[model samples]
Target: MTVLLVDAANVVGSRPDGWWRDRAGATTRLLVRLAQLPERRLSGPDGGVVVCDGVVAVVEGKARDVPAPDGVRVERAGGSGDDALAACAARLAQEGTPLLVVTADRGLRARLPAGAAVAGPGWLLAALDETGCVPPA
Candidate 1:
């Protein structure tokens, strides 16, 4: 299955829509977008997990255990989310799961495996459109 590891902070900071001004607003928007993720067509399993610095406890679009109606999962990171993600990616890669790391941080990118796919926020937004990750409002 494709396990999408999302970097919440990086994504929020990547947009120039003034999301940084309001962390909650940015997080809500991102979660909504994540909830709209689409089914994978890559000839294998696919899923997405959003790593946030803090936990929201409950999210409007959350779908419990199962993948979101679309194909994403939202999660909160403990103290070191990025480190955890990199480590998870490495382990998942070893197990043969397609790991797509979404982040704009150059430093974090260096830690991913050499062959892992990395995309910035702009790229992710475009992908959302391409994958129809979000349904029509």
Candidate 2:
């Protein structure tokens, strides 16, 4: 199964939707949108197809309190969200699960385990738009 790990802060921040005003609200909206998505078969940046089987969002700071929707799992970071994401990625990689991390942070991208596929927030946002999962901006 291909697991998609989302950097909630990064993805939410990618869009200048005024997420900074209310981090928790923005996170909740993002999670709700994610829950509404049907199983997706997306084109990877490397010209391959990526089938997203499961989704996990790592939340931190003010957004940590946002509850997860039915189809999404929320991981609250006690401190650094990037650290939490890296740990999750490492664990998933060790289990031999195909992993895809969604984020635009170069440092976090560098920290991900080997064999883990990485996609930027633009990729995710475009997919959401294609599926009509995002609200009108």
Candidate 3:
């Protein structure tokens, strides 16, 4: 299965879109977008494969309790989001699943398994927008 790991704080904070005021709200919005990602299909030469089988949103601080949508899992980081992300990635990698980690933090990227696919926040945001799943303001 294709596992998509999202750094909730990093993705939400990627743009200066006033997410800091209500972190939980922003995280909820991101979860909505992430839920849509797995349903997205690329056409034509891309062969119409689904983007992901599941999405894991690693949330911390004020965003920990955001409800997850179907096909999405929320990982509450009682401490560091980066640490939680690393742990999640490691677990999935050990299971031999294809891992795609969404984050812009270099340090977090360094912690992922060697074969984990890494993409920046803008990449995910653009894909969400393309699928008409823009995050709420």
List per-candidate RMSD values in Å.
7.9, 1.8, 2.9
For candidate 3, lDDT tens digit of each residue in 28-129? 988987887675552212233435677888999999988888868899999999999999999989989877788999999998999788888887787777
lDDT of every predicted structure (CA atoms)? 0.58, 0.86, 0.82
Worst 10 residues of 1 by lDDT: 53-62
Once superposed on the true structure, which residue ranges of model 1 sit more than 4 Å away at CA? 40-70, 131-137
Q: Which ten-residue region of model 2 has the weakest summed lDDT? A: 128-137
Summarize candidate 1's per-residue lDDT along 22-114 as a digit string, tens digits: 666666666667665534442111234433221111222122222222334555444565776677667767988666677787888999988
- Residue ranges of candidate 3 with Cα displaced over 4 Å: 42-50
Best by TM-score: 2
Task: In angstroms, give how far residue 12 of model 2 lies from its true place.
Answer: 0.6
User: For model 3, what is the error of residue 73's alpha carbon versus the real structure, in angstroms, after optimal superposition?
Assistant: 0.6
Clashing pairs in 3: none
Question: If the candidates were sorted by their TM-score against the true structure, best first, what order would they fall in?
Answer: 2, 3, 1
Per-residue error for 23 in candidate 3, Å, reads 0.6
The deviation in Å at residue 45 for candidate 3 is 16
**Model 2 misplaced stretches (Cα beyond 4 Å):** 135-137
TM-score, model 3 to reference: 0.89
